[model samples]
Target: MWWGHPLVAVLTVWTRSAWGFSNGRVGVACGDMGPQHGPRPRPDPPPYSLSVDKPSFSPGEPVTVSLQALNGSFFRGFLIEARDSEDLQSPAVGVFSLSAPQQSQLLQCRSAVSHRTGSRKTHIQAVWRSDRNPPHSVQFLVTVVQDYQVYWVRITGPLVVLRGATESPSTAPPASPSSPAVLSAPFSSEGCGLTKSCLREPEGCRPDSDHRCVFLSFTADASGRSVMFELSGPAEGYVSFALSLDKWMGNDDVFLCVKDGGGVSIRAGYVSGRTQPELHPQESLWGGAWRLENGLIQCRFHRNSVLPPSFSFNHSLFVFLACGGAHGGSVLKHQEQPVVSGRQTVISGPPEDLRGSRPPLLIRLHGVLMLTAWMWTASCGVLAARHCKHLWSSRSRPGHTLWFQLHRTLMVLALVLTAVGFTLPFLYRRGWISCQRRDCDHEAQAGCRTGFLLAGSMQDSYSERDTHLTGPHIYGLPARQHTHLELPLKFQDTTLPDEMLVKIQITFLVKLLENSSFVMPPLLCVCPVSFSSVRVCVGLRSDGDVTHTHRLHSE
Candidate 1:
């Protein structure tokens, strides 16, 4: 039906509209909803973008990367993911989120990444769902380039920094006639790259005249902590260096200190500097070169109550040239020369024994002199007594000529004997006593031929006998045999009557004899008798019989 007039011919025929038409389905009348429209769609948002302030960094540096969303309407929020080139598939890749209207987020790239040399890339992506067919992804690439900067300085061979003079390898060359010498390298107390000359040459280093003349000057913060100073160039021999504390402290403090290759201290100070009164011309200022392996010169300042602040002072080293050529020719020549004087005597015995033996000869001489003086006094007394008796008897005869002659002659003879005896000991005391070589002579007395006993007993005895004449041991005495002796003694009584005295004495004798058979012998024959505790007693009877008693008591 033709419905030209809107709504006028609608009742005439019912026809299906294109919108309602279905294949193989009954047609239905179309109702006109003219120009119908659903809710309008919003415009699609633009993709997100990422930017990094810096992607390349040196070791120990930090970099920051930021993510930005270009269009806000893409999604309610976006998830940002960052992955390193080697960790792209790792679930632990750095991920973060930014809500709509949020434009950027920051990620810190650590300096540890610099460990990997060469170029590396980090992929930064943002994912968001939009009204489009599927989720959209936007990515940016960050390239991390590793750049490493290192600085170091080394002294070659034996060349060291010169003190007082500014010329050095690290010192800048003089510009012209106007400029003073300056260090080529910057001076620093800490951190890397600070360098100075070595006081001694390193092993295998060539020893040119100029190189040997120079030495290293190292200054520390006065903490005395060991520091490493590198030496480069040709290595050779034991490098000997000296530390001059004179400038920092005083000349007295200047010591040649050396540490061995094994890091132990080998020697210090002047080797021949002794605290004696005499000065030797051979002794020079104590210093010289040591082996090269001992190139490291460590100087320790003595800690004291008046020490300066740790940062106040510094350590300095100096190089002492070899005496002559680099081959140690000077040392060899010095060793070949013979020693002429000032040789020290070596005393080897134990100190105490040496001291003890020094006085015996003197003491023996004095003892002999004392004996002679006593003998002289005794002879003079006898002569004086004899002269007095002669004077008393010859009062009428005026004087006895024979008596006077005899007295004078006797004194002269005594003096001669005394002088000889006194002088005899001096020979032995003065170390002059020596035995004479003897020929075999059977006609000589056997004892005389055997030589006289030079050492005799010097002790005194009550019997006026020489102790040397007694043998050290003797046998055949009672004490040496049965170690017993019987003594009988009787005491007469005058105060009491004979009858009473006899009765009392008998009673006492009976009591004493009761235990006589069991008593120990008074004369002890014990091989080792203790004289300290030996006691003996004798009981006497009126008839003059004696009983011996013995007792041993401890004090």
Candidate 2:
């Protein structure tokens, strides 16, 4: 009875309308395995394979596209474009070109799709070209879905890892369906610490001193799918959770708006560089569900959205917790921390991976050796300057001065050290970079070294890209000094809690010396220092700048 004329025609019309299929094409009805249907014809296989590194992505995030030659022939180059639709009239979000390839290659691209465009689809098409063969093209599709998981990553600087606990990826909370992951970390801001009392200072987070010291703890549900963060402090007014993905200051930024017991549903939005995050309800895919209980501000977000946009999983992510106005007028106070530094705050990974996380040991040794040589040379220069009169004195000499012989001997030693140190880093890198099993797996190791060389090659380009910054930044150039001679620490090869911070200070000192009126060669004037032993002597010039300074230290 149901297989009659009117019923069959009605069902056919409904099916065609639902699936948007043309009447001329044969279509298979649901649950109809009849003989007339035969078997659905298989479409032709693709000429090549296209894939991306991540499971999914958010707008503005960079993605790595991998192209593999499937047939007998390999592609030489490619012209790739990303579009929202197949319509010929639809404009592409961006276009890129790949240089000559070696069978397979991974390329990077930044998605320009707007988050406000609800459930829009993206299509990426690559047309491969070669000199001796015909051009081949391939297409791939990506779906945009709502991100329900929120990742609550913790960032601690080198200063916090005072204890010698190995902070590797293997230590990460294992997946468990039964229990929530509880993390309790204590961060103290003393009476006059950076964020509270010095709020108006250049390095401070905000200009308000009303901020009080605070401690925070978090509980993430199984599998890191959900998180509940509780903040305990004098955090009155608006609370803000800012996620920094790209650079420390400006890049792809996501912000969460905090209010009452359950203020408007948790909200988050993205901003590039210094622009304010575009926070609007209609366009955001982040659910932003949060609540405040027992004087603690509790917030949750899609965890997967917190991961880096590209291939870097261990990238150091900066999360800033601050107090601002309810409407996001300006921040009052905040604490910023680095979650994963390849050296100090290690977020568990395989042992080999952890080793690879560090720049090759030889390279670090090379840095120390070169620094030692440069520091020795500069120390000799300063000593010679300070005791020139004593060196040429008709009578014997002063007790402190090594009578210039010590300085000359140091100069010779520095020269020798410089040569050896300069040659050490290159010893392992044959004519080109070589991969070693002790360091990492072949692919990742190769990629790391390649990325380093590439970044070094494009340092100027990178700096230029960062110069046009847009956000609220307080850092500024140092005040001009009339005369300055900076003495850096000597023998800096050691594992200590505050060593990196000291090195940073020394670097700043070196930079100031370079900018001073006394033009000493900056690169050759490096020094290192050892903790627990040191001596410093300063000589001032007529222009009120320290013309000569010496720091003696022993480990």
Candidate 3:
């Protein structure tokens, strides 16, 4: 009962104990060592007491513990643990082994005994061995269940002493100098880039001036033997930073300023991969202080600059800043991308300004390339091929038309840049990233279709022999021709003469046709220019005689 709920809690109740709840065996009930027995007797004193076989013990030594009924009565279930006599609120600190295995079970609290079955028993025996980091003294606490309704919680037992410890059960726990302290004044950026290595979001924001700033700063002492670190950010849960060897997040030294109730807890941890960082005991710290005000969490502490062999005073490392939700004392995954420094910074090196961005370098590059291709290069190329063709008609390039050469070069460059820009995001993310701008299934499929359409328009403008355009839709063609020119084309395998080709092949750019036979002047197309007439006539000159005449019209 003294030991509270640790991480990953689960409660198992059998039969009537599972009333009004599903899952007879696995149900979400209690977080602490107490049973979810509901209404209370104000915790009636249990008719049992804990007894130990020894009065004093050393570290890693076993001591037999017994939970026996004082009134010769039996209990249906029980939970037992050894808690520090000094800090009764902390968790248990040892491993347990049962001597009577049939009547008891070990729980997620591996250092204690819980019920295996609800069968009644008068006594339970076990052995609890102290770990290396044991307290000076301990006292056993048991929660015993009489049948089901009558159970007592946190029933205190005899105090066990550690051999030769100066502590007595009656003596109060000493005041710790490293106990969580408080800060009244807010943090500042007055000495940044001059005496301390500082990293702040928005580049040069001062924490004292801007409450929205997420800041971290470290300053080495005159002797360079230790460093003082400060962190300030607005979070309901926590704000943290990690010192990574590279841009990635694994195998890094991490620290956190967790907001708990009205105060904060400074934590030291290390990351193994992309996993939750494993927390370590904090004891080497000094001058630790924290403040919580106006939705902002701030903390500062001091530690030796020389950590282990892997980390030193002058090692270059990237710093990452992230903030996210947390429940109780466990942290949650970050909600958005974290800020990462553009380059590494040495903690003990000369103080200087630092710059960083939330998005990765590759993602930023994708945006620049795509904007240039879509907004500037592609649009200019389309205009040049349409209106500027006549400007360069007199010049020629090697074996190709000068206007066609310029148009092809510009469009081709646009296509190449678009392709490279789209591919970089996939390379950085290791997969296709969906466009969040709209509710599309994916980004790759949409981008590919757009690229194909752009390429098709550019290709069809140059290729005179493409079969799709030869279907008599001549006005849409990007070309020019005058009357009395050799058109060099045939209809139904019969060659049309030059003069007839001009009259029927297409309407002139700025001229109406002369009086024609069976003209259809009323046909109107939705385009920049209107058609005066559309007609075709062919003569089969076999044996130099007009054998037959054929006519076609848009009537």
Candidate 4:
């Protein structure tokens, strides 16, 4: 064993060197038989080396420091820690473990620690130990850079109303000094007492004083847009108001007003409505104009209408005014002044001044509806006429009685509906009456006269009404003077012109044939005749000696 020991030592040393651990310690010994106790090989000391990269971070920003261990024998784990200048020996700011395959660790600094001049620093170190060796450590410094920016928010328009006796917690009062009552005078002055005291009462007129009083209060957002408002009456009554930011106002600016029967009272600006009476008492009115000035919106309401009042007997004066304006911002102030009685009340606000017109699509749709109704009525009349004949011919067949009854019923219905439909256009055109006065009497009397004439003409002159014809001429002579005439059948006088006389003869023939079904001819086979042509020929003959001969042909 002693003889080969030196060779074993040499081989072990070669193996250690090949593995890059040649400097590490190894033991050796020699036997007496071989050169007895030769010098023992000295233990090679463990190698140790460390490398660190520069730290990178912004002020108030998080940073990570890393240290690399190299040329170390019997390698162990590493330690990482950091601290700011505020403490000389603070607890390790952070600690991390090191592992194989490029071992590394991370440490985080508290966000509160800002990077000031020499105020922030990060320290990193790696700890490792070899077998039977004292622990060794490597460290690196981390410099922190200061980087920061300032931020803030700005608000435009009036500040929010914090508190006041009369002021609304949510909105600011309108800055306008004039009351709406004064602005809408004359028309508004006629019915109610103009005296200052009377105007203050809920009824709009104080019995003892002349001043009228109305109060309105509401909230608004940062943009001076109306949030909401409440109106109180002298009696047990009140009202609320709101509007949206987007609405169309035409040439006449929209305004809200409280008026007596004669249109005398206080008023507010233009508002929106979801339903009748310009006030959507059921839904909260939102996103409408409250006031207009200098082309800017002073206030904007919520996007919905108010809910209906819970109690039926409760009286509320809520009203809405929609005016015209496109791209108006929000409501900023009430242009009208307040009326004061016992308490300050908003009488009226700035009138909603809108800028644009309505779309053309709505007008076109209305016209289409009117035309469709007219065409439908005419078609119904023609269809009834055609179907009535079939039912009349089949009346004798079994089960045909129902069809005949239905046909008769439908014919009457169609006739009545067609008459109403035909009259509508004439009425709209104001052709049903010739009267020009706007008074109720004139209108009623004209309507009565039109109704009477229509009823009489329908009953007594059915043939003339249906055929568009006229009456007879003198001594059965065909007078060629009259061109277009429509007359009732009750007149037996034969002094009418030739065209009128021919129409009467044809009407008489038609009635005679209809009354005597037994002797009736096939009138449908007669075909349509052009009376205009026949009249032209007759008129030519009446002209002085024209001598134009015309042949009459029948098919």
Candidate 5:
């Protein structure tokens, strides 16, 4: 049974008396529909199986169908019919007869599937009938995938669709107008490409008259759940694709690969939370499949693994493409993140539509304030150290000590500046920290210990002074053996606020059996000058005898 259109093909299997003609019908076997004049004889079943090379076929691609018929002696004549899944009428049909009934034979046919404007799934059915058996049919389904497509976005230019580049090439040459491009080193954040809407390029992608470019063409196999990327650039180097989960540098999840002209490829992955993306040393990530042919590097990876496990197809992803040109012949020069000298492109896919959005306003303000306060504190401290000497000078330098008046003024000015600078951060968060130290060991046998005051709270906790620092560590005492200094301190108040009222007491224990004179180092104190005032007191005791007392203040 032949259809008038050349595109229609039907396979028909018939016997001498049984002419099976089944068309445009459903759930009806071909043998039952044969021209029936009277009751016919039933034949033995044919020993054969029908199979196709591949389960699916794209439009215009040919499918190879084979039927292996064994013990041909059981059948003196036979016929087979192949029909389209949608329109069963007018199928391309073929028939054959066994001259010598003792041999086995194979039946094969090749046909092309017509291209449809839209993607569709359909099947082709093959039915066989013989002298000894009823009509037997088998069906196979195939999906006709549409051709590949590409959208190009130039750095410093508008996003444009390159219509002619849909034909995927095996390899890329140095220059091709139709090639999808990466477009220069140190790729800026200004431009990228996607399969969907084409958005305008940002200001950062504006070209500065000198830029290099790269091109990429890709196709997806939906049945296999994989995508193939074909890359061509100036270098015979390597290529990589990165999925930035947060659209930020130093945090991209990337897949890197290298392929030689011989079609051998090696790959690596920088996944999980790897800040510095590098190929995994122990595992090869090219489990899917890849090749380099005709100067074009082709790579395929599973769609499910393109992003981190934390992200799904529904979540937006920042996609990046990069190429490492060959330096000479032995070593490949690849670009690091922020690709200074290399070219790159950033494309966004799914969910969020925009790339490279600015940070929130409050975050910017907090950074500026903290930086300014730190700078002010450092400058004031340096100036005070260079000019003020009254704070550290002793009575031995009587003549030079006359400069105390000028020194005190500079010292006070520095304190006021430092206090203001140091208080800004605390003011922003209403928190500050203070420390007090005491050495209670009278014979200098115990090691040094430290304490702390928790910021922004009245409660305090102290750790046991277990660590030893007694290796003759005489920090502010006269240089002599068997001579020691003991200091004890207590804090009466613990609250810290804009105006913290702090009450502190100190005791000094000095043992001087060989030396008569004792000296006390100047104590430094600072408080938030914006609230009120600050004061410091020092008492000197020698050989178990009270000697001198001094009080310092600045309001």
Candidate 6:
């Protein structure tokens, strides 16, 4: 009985390890394309075939590669790599990106890409690019995992000789245009919580057959080995979804379905903070397909129920959907706030309907506080100070006039509201977010208007922060342009007899430096130095030398 108990414990430990592999964390098998299924791969011929688009390519050129089940059946998992054709034992020479990033992921070394989940797939297409200094002849080597013990290892794939060299014997056929890479029809939402989990814009809008419906759904398979996801939305450049621990954007697993001309590019990425995502190889998805009909972009894909080890161990995550434009593969920020799930959810858990909202509560309050302060309180404070001084002429409170008290209270309240509103977004996002000159958020717009109030109230303090740049970036001054303004000192002019030559070239980095109306008039009075009096300050720890361009002119 004691021996039996020990054997059962050993079996339990083995089962747990195998369970993790079943979810497709197979970096351990990267050296040799083999599964740790406790059985040698069968010697029987595989029912699969590998295909490529062209026969040969130049160095660092992209080639389309496909793995197909010849018998028209589904394969559970697969690993494909590019290797030296002459030496099969060498490491993978090129890299691969998947057409679908849902059920697959790039390996640790990025030399190959494999299934991230055990979801069944029929055909797979990947873009493999050779390195700048690739092997003279490269061949793709594939290992298809049909079952725990029924997989085929080291299946020889197509070979490509170097460009300008003689062509080798062709092993794979050309890619077919009539492949299963395109969706046959539009998605339908006939079954919601009864069959799968659904999240749709406009509450109950159906995505089935309607191009206008913005919808997202996820369903775990009956065996719980994998989950399939569908996302349909209207976006000109890109539509994306993310799995996050909370409603915030940082530290999340994001997937993008970017519109690349005629077709779509599905990619996997990770968000470090509120910045552009770090995209993974195209080989990170499974059974991926996209449809661009009318203006809506629809995509379908699959992934494992168990998240990858590199991803967090937390299975419960909040879903986020966002849309944005990408310029030449660099994705921009979402046009607006993302639609987030109300509660945390485990994708593999029981099916349930989920609802979400676009803006956070903090954001709404921030907007209200900013609008009230700027449009109402601030305006009233200025009116009381400038116009109502005579109306409340009597010193009602013994020392302070009623208008003075009112103006002070209103101004103080406006400043407090502005500061609190500005701080709210920082609290919500937990950090600063980068934005373009034109694409700033509401918080930024409000902060810009209110920032001047605080800076003007506080006396200018000589504070210096660290600077990394040592170029023309510090002052955005033109290299050759030297237009100057005049400040009067004692008249000792060299050219003009009665005029004093004090070339006032104010350099204000933080302020919006427009010499005309939009510029802050108060900042100009902080320190007016004659360009001739401006000595070069080059501290050892400072960014660099501050050049006095108007040194050429003198009195």
Which predicted model would earn the best lDDT? 6
lDDT of 4 by residue, 258-353 (tens): 322322222333222221122222122332333222221122233111111111111122222222211122222222222212222222322221
Candidate 3 stretches with Cα past 4 Å from truth are 1-179, 260-263, 282-287, 325-337, 349-361, 389-401, 427-555
Estimate candidate 6's alpha-carbon lDDT, on a 0 to 1 scale.
0.67
Task: State the lDDT of candidate 1 residue by residue for 1-555, as single tens digits.
Answer: 555686655643343232121111111111110111121111111243345444332222322444343334122211233322221222212323333122333233210011111222223332221121211111223221111111110101111111233332211122231111222332222222133222232322332332432222332323232222222111222222222222111111212222233321222232212121111111111112222321322222221111111111223222222211123211111111111111111111111100001123434564565455436643553455344444643422434444343444444454454555555544433433233223222222221211121112111221111111123321222222123333222222222332343344334433333322111122221212232333344443323244556443443
Clashes of 2: 23
* Per-structure clash totals for the candidates: 38, 23, 0, 78, 31, 11
lDDT of 5 at 267: 47
Cα lDDT tens digits for candidate 6, 305-370: 432322421268898888878788667777778888889887877887889889899999999998
Among the numbered candidates, top TM-score falls to 6
Instruction: Give each model's whole-structure lDDT.
Output: 0.26, 0.34, 0.64, 0.27, 0.31, 0.67
N/CA/C clash count, model 1: 38
Taking all chains together, each candidate's TM-score versus the true structure is 0.14, 0.27, 0.46, 0.22, 0.26, 0.50
RMSD of 4: 34.3
Of the two candidates 5 and 6, the one with more favorable TM-score, higher being better, is 6
Off by over 4 Å in 4: 1-174, 178-321, 324-374, 384-392, 396-408, 415-456, 460-555
Q: Give RMSD to native, each candidate.
A: 42.1, 25.7, 19.6, 34.3, 25.2, 19.2
TM-score of 2: 0.27
Worst 10 residues of 6 by lDDT: 512-521
Model 6 TM-score on a 0 to 1 scale: 0.50
In model 3, the worst 10-residue window by lDDT is 510-519
